[model samples]
Target: MPKFTGYVSDHTKFIEELKSKTPGMEERQQEGRSLLWDKLPISLDEEARTRESRLRQNAYPYQNKF
Candidate 1:
């Protein structure tokens, strides 16, 4: 198992700490897709082709849709 940083052992204690340290944190959540279309490198086309080949090599049958 992997452990995440800044996590507490107890849930209640974690919530209390979070509330005191970062008030109104829930109001700042991201609501929709923020485009990164301009940030992609020119080599992205080549990288994507490589990724598609790799995925095709390890393709598995679709078992469910939800």
Candidate 2:
């Protein structure tokens, strides 16, 4: 298996910690879902949507790359 780094590794560890901390199945499932949303590349459409949303929200300064 390939090793994850940076934010991916951090979030993976966070989800594991969350699972260890939570006892209920539903709670773990919810936490897993949240982590999946943050980390997984479920689809290109989802990826594009996330990038577009972040750009619109001005999470980073806009720059023209032309």
Candidate 3:
């Protein structure tokens, strides 16, 4: 088996080209991602309270019994 060295895939090339064309693009992407995805650590009490407050759905929710 031969390993292909110094070979850039099309996807990698596209990303590199995009980054080169747009200055601070990576930083903006990071900021956007952090805004949506980055989160502070949740305390155990908060997590337990959140879990305990959830309402359970009845089985066979479509059918109602009076």
Candidate 4:
């Protein structure tokens, strides 16, 4: 076997250490990611409305477009 450097070789042990230090760590991580990053699809009508709104911004707002 090669000499062990400071870097970790055992990934499972590392995860165990994290789980032990923080209770409900994995479950909370899943929930937080779902709340912030997970994308649910909007309704087709909502999507069409958004697309229609985008078509209205022809000029930059700084030009005082009415």
- RMSD of each predicted structure: 16.0, 12.5, 2.4, 5.2
Off by over 4 Å in 1: 1-9, 30-66
Q: After superposition, how far is residue 8 of candidate 4 from its true place, in Å?
A: 9.9
| Span of ten consecutive residues with least summed lDDT in model 1 | 29-38
Over all chains combined, what TM-score does candidate 4 have?
0.54
TM-scores of the candidates in the order shown: 0.27, 0.28, 0.74, 0.54
| Better candidate number, 1 or 2, judged by TM-score | 2
* Backbone clashes under 3 angstroms, per model: 0, 0, 0, 0
Q: Is candidate 3 or candidate 4 better by lDDT?
A: 3
Residue 41 accuracy (lDDT) in model 1? 64
lDDT of 2: 0.73
Q: Order candidates by TM-score, high to low.
A: 3, 4, 2, 1
lDDT of each: 0.64, 0.73, 0.95, 0.85
Which window of ten consecutive residues has the lowest lDDT sum in model 2? 55-64
Best of the candidates, TM-score: 3
Task: Estimate, for each residue in 1-66, the C-alpha lDDT of model 2 and write its tens digit.
Answer: 976554567788887887777769676677999986767547989878888888344455586545
Model 3 deviation from the true structure expressed as Cα RMSD, one decimal place: 2.4
- State the lDDT of candidate 1 residue by residue for 1-66, as single tens digits: 977878666987988799789966655433222342335465988988888888443254665545
What is model 2's C-alpha RMSD? 12.5
Compared to the true structure, candidate 3 yields what TM-score? Answer: 0.74
Where does candidate 2 stray beyond 4 Å?
A: 1-8, 25-66
CA error at residue 33 for candidate 3, angstroms: 1.6
Q: Which pairs of residues collide in candidate 2?
A: none
